[model samples]
Target: MASPRELTTPATLTEESVRRYREDGFVHVPRLLSPEEVSVYRAAAESILERDMEVWAGGDDGAAVEVNYTTQVWRKDETLRRLALHPALTGIAGRLAGVPLRLYSSEVLVKEPEGAPPTLLHDDEAGLPMDGLEQTLTAWIALVDVPVERGCLSYIPGSHLRADSERLRHMTSFEQFREPDEVWPDFPWRPRVTVPLRAGDVAFHHCRTLHWAGGNETDARRVGHGVIYMDAGTTYLPGVMDEYLAHMEPGQPLDDAELFPIVTS
Candidate 1:
């Protein structure tokens, strides 16, 4: 395995990259990690998975199928924490956001074999009171190869810039948006492109990007680990933000606590 510095270049996002992002709502960054780093994190995750299975009883497929390991990884895994704060990503995030960035949270999303369901298409901002678009972003890193047949992510290009009314109709989750079919009755469901990623590739998407991941149809599992980033000066929405902040001690900033601990300043 190569060092992260050796594996990734110092990404200087161009106007075209920014323009594409503004127009498409997301961009796929290829080969963001070296094979070595990918292996380290995957092994760490596999260790946790094995432990979870051993400690917990009753290996019912349905119960095991729905599991999503996230918070625990951030709390106990150093390798994952390092990956969350990788310089290549944070620098690009800062440039894209035009401000200092802080890691908001990290999660491990595992779409189990065969029985996993399709995730609803929606924007992250629908559930929060964000004042503007540039304040929040997400870096979704693929830990294994993901093909469309194996439940790769699909997005509606340029939909991030759509009006609230138009956007709302495409979201169907508790996140406060309608399903895509409801919004675009005449539009065909064909994806613009199926984002195929190698183990180390990462995709950076805006908070408002309308995206979804289908179920894992193959025998092998599809897994992604996401580290959400927010511009340092961004404020938290009062009601919904309170739930995550409640666990913090008085006077402690939200980024300083365990839940949204700042992996990078």
Candidate 2:
């Protein structure tokens, strides 16, 4: 386990890992957080979800939502904010991206045992409200050990190389309302790489990489923190987050310190 001071220090990445990210569009980093760090984050996340978050249900059944997420969590809890801005996290993200990055958003995701459904396979680029989409990525940090049966993430290797226009078209036309196994008949299929992580492990994937997670079968909840990082000059576009970024011009760069701060050491 890393000492408290070491947890705040910038993480070191190897050339092999950077190369893997460039070629595969995803890379896993082991022990990104210490055991002590995980305990603190897990407690903070659980408390925030229970007390502050209003989890939204996806279906029209009007069922009471008891699991899932709160977006931009960094803006709510100081402890979670520290996790988002942690030097190790930002440093690893910057290194993997091979460029300066700006924080786009951070979310806490939870999949309850036995009840949560499997997340569908999709690329973030299909839904993101940003220009220069190629330069965006997400770092998913596990707060607890996530085995295959406990909702670990899986990705189609190198799928990020596909054209963005095609992905968006297919997503809008065919994937809007379907189950995880359901997809457009012509959608290209590839073998997936399932990534199981220890409590402190983190996996970084390109925004365009096709990915999904399995439902938790174990008794414990599968909790994760995902932080999206984009190129420093990424500009705003009209979409899901329009209300939040309404102050900025349609094509304006998202440089606001409060919402989209630069990830620095």
Candidate 3:
């Protein structure tokens, strides 16, 4: 196992990967975590999920097959918090963002055996209550082998590069209200790419990238840890998420030492 300092000192990323992330709006890093580390996270995530947590199933009709998830596990578990601020992870995010980054939030998402439904296509920025939406992205670490049969993630390539337009705006709004099982054949978003990851692999996607995951068709469980990172200067948008971020005023930086630790400086 590599020491934390070693992991932080030299990030495991290539210039080509960075360029590909910029062009495609996402990048995959194989074996970002060691087998032992994968075991640790799997245990931690499972323990956290075992406790009472929120369950979100897409639209109104999807509640029957809700996906179980818990956010900000870093607040409760030291190991997860360390993973959230891991140097290698932060280094990848900072290099991709071209700026220093800070922790926005961390979540563990799970799909039960034959119980989870397909996730709707949506951009993270539409749901996040932050001003610097463009500067945000998520590092999704697979704790278990996520094959297509197990509902791996899929994304619209280069979707992040599209300028804000009426069509994009409408599509974002429509997605928010669409049912979990609904699929628009002529929805216009195209050239989608599905990514299957083995345990210990990580996928990084821009917040604006349109992405979704399939249903858990296999009998095994599918679990993923997603750590959202954003520019250090990103500010809170008061009305959107007043309950969770009321401590900070509108336009104020999300720099709480304990809540939003600076990952890259």
Candidate 4:
């Protein structure tokens, strides 16, 4: 495995990079992780899938055959956690958010070859009902090389600054909210860029950026992981409109513990 130093570099996002992000609402950081690191993560993912295949296959009776999100893979899987909180990625997120960042959530989204549905199109903030324009950032890391034809990500640049419209619809996954005509009426709704990524490349997007991913038509699998980061001062809105500050545990603040445990006052 590559040393942590290779993966974690303390560099500021360039002016052009920041400008492009503000203009397009997203930026792609190519080769963020070494091939060795990528391989480690890939092996970890496969191990997880193997252990959970019974559950994935809908274990025992027919009752277990339902498709559900699995948090266990992340909680127990060391490699996933390591990659999720990689310093280089979090440092960039911290810079973007303008506050100390915390791991909001970690998830692995795998689209199997053929027959899988596209993820709904919507902003990340749509899931959390909070007023004001405070932004949350998401780092999407590809575990395997992905081509445009094999379900790479598509985005509408600079759409994050726009107000949330009725065009935004609620769905179980991010891909369902896509209605290109409703979101972009002027131009022919073609993506300016199709992010074809090598393994370990990361794409960072603002919370409100408009993006979507299509179904995988290839015979191979398309797997990616997402790690969301929120600025330090950001409050977690539990239940309804009530805001609760995060309380951190000693050195564990930098690492994932629970949801913002320490609310710095």
> Rank by TM-score, descending?
2, 3, 1, 4
| Candidate 3 lDDT by residue in tens digits, 1-265 | 5454332222557778889999999988777777888899899888888884677744476364536789888787888887887777777888888877888889888888875788767777756667766668999989999998887899887877766642232222333444222333433746789999998888899987889988898999999989999878887765433477866677887877777888877
Pairwise lDDT winner, candidates 2 and 4: 2
For candidate 4, which ten residues in a row score worst on lDDT? 237-246
- What is the lDDT ranking, best to worst? 2, 3, 1, 4
Which of the two, 3 or 4, has more lDDT? 3
List, residue by residue over 73-134, the lDDT tens digit for candidate 4: 44568888888777777766665555556566666667677645555565676554332325
After superposing candidate 1, which stretches have Cα over 4 Å from the reference? 1-8, 12-15, 50-67, 128-133, 169-177, 180-191, 238-242, 247-265
- Pick by lDDT: which candidate is best? 2
Per-candidate TM equals 0.76, 0.87, 0.86, 0.72
* Candidate 1 lDDT tens digits, 1-265: 4444454444545667766776787878777777888888888776666555322221355454443555545656788778787788777766666565667777777777776666656667665433333557888788888887667787777666666655552222344445655765533554554577778888878887777777787788777887788756555444333455554454334455455544345
* Model 1 residue pairs with clashes: 170-178, 171-177, 171-178, 172-178
After the best TM-score superposition of candidate 3, give how far the Cα of residue 88 lies from its true spot, in angstroms: 1.7
Worst 10 residues of 3 by lDDT: 166-175
CA lDDT scores, all candidates in order: 0.65, 0.80, 0.77, 0.63
> Across residues 141-192, which tens digit of lDDT does each residue of candidate 2 receive?
9999999998999998887776533455223333363432344333556678
Clashes of 1: 4
What lDDT, from 0 to 1, does candidate 4 have? 0.63
lDDT at 143, model 4: 85
After superposing candidate 4, which stretches have Cα over 4 Å from the reference? 1-8, 52-69, 72-74, 129-133, 164-192, 238-257, 261-265
Higher-lDDT candidate of 1 and 4? 1
